[model samples]
Target: MIRSILLTAATGLLLSACAQPPLRGTGDLGVVIERASGSVQIIESDSHTALARLEGLGDLSHASVVYSRDQRYAYVFGRDGGLSKIDLLSQRIDRRVIQGGNSIGGAISQDGKLIAVSNYVPGGVKVFDARTLRQVADIPATPLADGSKRSRVVGLVDAPGQRFVFSLFDTGEIWSADFSQGASPKITRFNNIGQQPYDALITPDGRYYMAGLFGEDGMAQLDLWHPERGVKRVLGDYGRGQEKLPVYKMPHLEGWAVADNQAFVPAVGRHQVLVMDARTWRQTAAIAVAGQPVFVTSRPDGRQVWVNFAYPDNDRVQVIDTETHAVVADLRPGPAVLHMEFTARGDQLWLSLRDGDQVQVWDPYSLKPVSTLPAAAPSGIFFSSRAQKTGY
Candidate 1:
């Protein structure tokens, strides 16, 4: 009896300790997940170490991660259609939500109230309650050009009026859905925005949503409020065919960032990040990079841009000075720089190196690698603020 009582007391004490709020600023690093390795590492600002490494939730190499607005939780989605809720404070997976069907990508609302994931095979977007990570609604697949197959929601953006905008790679269209209610949500066909719309980012003010058109002239900009306003071509051709070519054979625009009244687009074929003014929608500058860059993200402070390339030999992360519009540094992290993300505070950068089977951390300002974290087939990563400790 005495031993059992003591053991119970010991366990209670440990649980109490785990329940306390984690060291602040540690969570400031936000969230990062490596798709191939099925590993997610969270680092706080400038911390020489990682706060927590949540592992084995699912196959991360093909998953997409997003942080809740409160920065407390991370929602992970696998390409096979598995969703897991991770507790940021405890550094453990809380539960798994089976989103029946294959997923291409997913996103969390800025308000942290909802999460929506694309089901490619079935052609639909599943919306869930941010708190419970429970399915609230399933928006059906929006139509596309005939014979194009239901375009997968490769990229999604939450907008006003409980509406979410998703991009389709197959048909080059953007669809809008409403998830105001917990069930029976409404979906609408917004417009055919561009060709091969892979990713999108909304302006800070929510005035416009810009979709990166891969293998096209440039970014296709749409009025978030009025999707029927047709579309405007923002950045110029990325030099796909000679100096300038017809729209059909344009090289392509893959990754993009909207900041400081300019949209920074990474033209993979051109090996350049074309900058365009948001208001005037004119070409401002073209920043050259090392290899076929895949992603262009803003520095934590939003003052600089970071470009990452793909495998089998993209061992470096390129840093571009947004102010000067110049390539500043190339950070050699390791093998295969597949996908990467930055913590909320922007103090640390997380990289998914496919060949290395590791997720690397870097100092955004100094361009120095801070640590190497374990991950499997590291792929998609996103930050979440609404995570919480769910008693398992």
Candidate 2:
């Protein structure tokens, strides 16, 4: 009887000595970029609370994030060419490296094993092992005709295969680095895609990769499934007759454009959002907005599309009914609305007000404020749901 009792007590003590099991999953967790401070506020979507603050991420003035396939980790790309791997459950930066001089954005491979960053100063795409932040391949941008220097890279995104596609801004060309084979990828070059391809995005299905043209009125689209068809220009004249304003890449391109059968794209320097037929790549309609639109994002449900403008009109937001192709709600939020993110299923719409120093959530249907979370010069709000998304 004494030995049995001792054994029971010893087992209980050993069990208590072990670490506790994880209490929360990472699915509802995310991070908000604190641009000025070079830190991020780890937030929870359900409770609408900030759980942790991770600092020393480097220059995040133009920072962007992508997620691992499981959504447990976030990869942040900063303007100072710093790439950080953050673990949500641990609330810490797992790995970090200064991979470039100036990085605009980054994307994770389809398999979630690689991370690619598009740089401006060094002017190329750097690929690293997602977990270790170790360089695997270095693909340089095409050199200018005069060979003065390499062109700047933009619109870096991962496709269906284990490939990284990006555009060269100075040279107006698109290159595909197929990494599926191994560290040395097969490179395919599409020269003269446009005058200057500013930014790009891949369709949800990963079939079409479209790069926005800042030097022209149209965009360049490549059918990834059939790259042999070459790059085709779509909506070539949609912005020709509008009051054009020079289109620039937002600090954080959080606005998602493709929704179901239609693509809601922001017209280059116009107070309008152009609706295009996703199948034929033709303009169906151009809905006039409050000002020159900066971020044109659609809810996950594909039922509503919300827009935030640039400069003086940046405070106002408008929602469009995709079915009716009409502006439904006009909301006046805080100043300098930098970016917008929808909850995994569109239950809530979150926005970062840089000038307001706040993060606001709203009901996508009623267009009313749900909750307000204070932030420090917040620029981007990303949710873990992005882990399961393509071209995030």
Candidate 3:
């Protein structure tokens, strides 16, 4: 009788232990893009360790990912027009579809109901149901008056009111499509924004959309709040009277940093970052940088702007103080530093070094290396926190 009672009590204790919820790991999860192998390394920002590696993603050379609203799904936009919906918790691809022949990147709707892809082959934006990956709407980049061929679309982003905005590389136009009404989206196109809008970014507040022009000296801005006022070209003639250097690679506008009402934008072919007043839309100052700047991203806390370069200087990264407008720290993580991502609270920074095949984490305030995780030709490091923001 004593033995049976002891066994029953032990079984009851085991069941009680199992009934309690499993201890949750740190919620700071993210993914690092392995461009060469077409895979992504799931990592925890706090632990600085890779939890899993998901493979078989096609042509991730220029891949980008946006997370679902609940932070459970990752919508990966592949260079080959493949839209893959990944389950972050399960570390598996939930659903995927070939949306187009060639694609650049994509965005998720504000409400997490839709996903939009910018295409290079068909020259248009295709919207898909975020849950089912079903085709919802297709808006073509129609030809402008100067040409009969459709233009390639790039710089796609989600806005506040269930709208997706993008720029046309060939037509020099910016467009916004409203999907609040469902399958048939209402479209608005602004013309003559600039020449060769290589990339674009929407401000965090979702009020302004800025496109970096490669063929011209400045950028194009659209006030989303007042679209009838049309697109305004700002920072024009920035490189006037100076022989601009040949651009080896187009600087990405997605890296443009905005902090404390100032915008730090990469000067196309110059080894400098252009500072502009976000309110006035005027050039405030130019900070000389190490090399041709590609991404000038502001830290989450708005205290510093981190800048990365292209090609020859791609191995280095520089941080600028927002208050002083000065280059603070110049860091060399490794060769071919492709991207940088800060933790949601701005405590740490994760940088991907393609040539080194590793991701380095550092203290954002002290500029000290904290940890490193091995990866394979990593490019973009995206955090799950991005699921809550307008544009990631």
lDDT of 3 by residue, 1-392 (tens): 99999999999999998866344632588889999999998898877899889998899999999998888788999999999998777778889899899999999999999999999988999999999999989999977567666799999999998899999999899999999897899999998888888888899899999887767677788999999999987888543224377676677777888888898888878898998898998988999999988888788879999989998999899999989988989998889988888898999998999999999999998999999889999999999999988877
Single out the weakest 10-residue window by summed lDDT for candidate 2. 247-256
Global local distance difference test of model 3: 0.88
Tens-place lDDT per residue, model 2, 1-392, is 99999999999987876544356788998999999999999999898899999999999998989999888899999999999999888788999999989888989998999999999978899899888899999998888889888899999989988888899999999999999989888999999888888788888888888887766667798999999999999888643334356544331233547777898887756778888888999989889888878888888889899898888888899999999988999999889998899999889999999999999989888899989998999998999998888888
Clashes of each: 26, 1, 0
Name the top TM-score candidate: 2
lDDT of each candidate versus the true structure: 0.67, 0.87, 0.88
Q: Against the correct fold, how does model 1 do in TM-score? A: 0.79
* lDDT preference between candidates 1 and 3, better one: 3
Instruction: List candidate 3 stretches off by more than 4 Å.
Output: 1-26, 144-149, 238-243
TM-score of each: 0.79, 0.93, 0.91
Q: Write the per-residue lDDT of candidate 1 for residues 1-392, one digit (tens) a residue.
A: 99999999999999998878666532455556655456677655455445777767665545666666566677788777888877777678877877856776677664568888887877778888888887778766656658565667766766766667777777777776766664566656655566777667666565677676764656677786676686776665643323331232222122466677777876646566778876887888877777666678876576888887654337877888777887888778778777667665677777777778776778887778768766655655554432321100
